[model samples]
Target: MTLFKTVDATELQARKTAAEEQFRGRKSGIDHFAGNDPVTGRPVGGYVEGGIEAVLVKYAEDLIPVYVEYTTKGYTLTSVGVVSINSSTWEIYMNRPAEQVKPLLDAILQKVEDDYIAEIEVYNNAIVDKAVAEQLAMAERREAKELEEATKARRERIESEVRQGLKAPDLTKPKSGKK
Candidate 1:
């Protein structure tokens, strides 16, 4: 007892045609940008910009997959993985439906920007802390100088008062036992 009935040849052909048409229609909605080789103007799939070719090559030393993957339920499409790369431009084949690819790319770009901002914030905090420490040290030095000047002035005032009350003690004179 089979669960499915076999269709006629004509009906099967019609079904195949309909499925292809639907796939083509979905593919048509995606935007394609021309990524040319910056040096030769030859059409290329990807490019690595910013003069850091060695570093990128090192990371991509292994195989880079360009195929697309479907979600577990087959309802969503993952990234249109790396298709090609040239000297400074890269292309992602991403044969994804329009709705899926655009938002995914947007989210990825936003994440990168956010991470960059976080790193900058950490660097900025370090600089700010150093400046604050220097300012505190300067303030302490000023306070110490002010205290030293005040103590010197007080000592001079006390000596002057003693001199005015009694004659200056002679350096050569010996002290008497009786008051």
Candidate 2:
């Protein structure tokens, strides 16, 4: 008989539907399309048909060129081989069933989410650093202005004291006899 368990058309369809449902739930976090449907005015759903390629187009468009290579041994397609997914320079080789497209898409989506979070963190840190630096500079300038004003006030006080001393009568001088 056959080495592998046979999968009927109905079973395959059910598996595909389940996979699509899983994808729909997971895609909510990263879904950028927030437009409403033209016909009903309701929000557009995020489900796309046509297997892995469709999922990639709808969700992971940026991570394009995610190649899936399926190999069949003979004319009857008895022996199905491994699936290779190449995303950019990184290559993932797995022996997963071709019908299970959700797991592969899930992995890519996870990567996208992680990278997005890291980018946001970096941006926030930069803004905080810039704000702190601006505050420090402003404080330094205020301190310098206060110091300059204090020095000027001290100099004016010393000058006024010297002028008062000069204007005062000399005690050692004798009075005029004619007075």
Candidate 3:
């Protein structure tokens, strides 16, 4: 005897729609700027944005079936996924009863959530990298400016000494009479 229940197309579609809505609600609840550096505890700027392209439901009526399918540092990226019940069938089969449709949907949405989190990490890293690079470049520019100013000041001091009849002694020549 099979435990799997056969759902009609309309019922399956309704369930799929509800699942998609739930996914959207979850996605919307996520804080777009909630990323933080693990080491520093500072806010790393990145946005979490994506959409559900499509949600597919599989109706097993004594048959089988199957399926499947980033964000800003400076540039914005769009991501879309086609979430289907069959893709997570193995997980659902192993973890929950096949007749329980909600669990199956939840499993698929959980995968989607995991993917979203991964993308958020990627964007956070990118933002941090860009900020670090900018800081390094600023430091270099400041150092170069200081060096140039010091060189100019030294040159002015030397010129002033020469004007006041103080000449630097030449060490490359032999003494006048002790050659």
Candidate 4:
């Protein structure tokens, strides 16, 4: 489940607050986040405190894309509701005009120009990890093979010297056929 998608009016405002100039190169946001992630040294995905999505884009301030979700019931609007917490922020306060929301959202296009879907995976897939581990294991096996080859060469040298002291081969033997 995702919120603040499509870069709608409210999301545009949140983008403005976060600033598009900052989100360059990196992923936009997570599906859900619950505070920071220790493994990645970033925030984890789930839901931020107070049911808001707060992310600190690269070199940008925190983007709190507060949102709502309405589940349409059969007919009588039984489950018309909202999600995300609309609350205070420490930075400058912002409130949009009801009529000019579109224009305001449009203005953000100048700063952002275009938006792409942000994809973030929580863990490295098993296949990816397996490939990496296999590569590492192959490297170790190669090293072991080289070490074994070196030991074999040394052993052959030592054995050859011992055999030479016991009985050396005749260097001058009769030629099979005279030229």
lDDT (Cα, tens digit) per residue for candidate 2, span 14-41: 6555655555433222233556789988
Candidate 4 whole-model C-alpha lDDT, 0 to 1: 0.44
Q: Any runs in candidate 2 off by more than 4 Å, and if so which?
A: 1-104, 165-179
Candidate 1 on 109-175: residue-level lDDT in tens?
Answer: 5555565556666776777788899999999999999999999999999999998789788778888
lDDT of 3 by residue, 1-179 (tens): 63323334565556556656664433322454569899988876664322321223344421232221111112121143222356442211111122333554667666655655566667767777898999999999999999999999999998988867866677799787754
**What order do you get sorting by TM-score, best first?**
1, 2, 3, 4
**Weakest ten-residue segment in model 1 by summed lDDT:** 48-57
Off by over 4 Å in 3: 1-107, 166-179
Clashing pairs in 4: 32-45, 32-46, 33-45, 33-46, 33-47, 37-42
- Relative to the unseen true structure, what is the Cα RMSD of model 1? 22.6
Model-by-model lDDT, in order?
A: 0.50, 0.50, 0.50, 0.44
Q: Model 2 misses residue 107 by how many Å?
A: 3.3
Instruction: For candidate 4, write residues 1-179 as lDDT tens digits.
Output: 54223435666566655653332212223445546677877866762111112222222123323221111211111122222243433321122222333453455555453442231121224446777899999999999999999999999999999988988666689658879
Could you tell which candidate, 2 or 3, scores higher by TM-score? 2
**Best-fitting candidate, measured by TM-score?**
1
Per-residue lDDT of 152 in model 4: 100
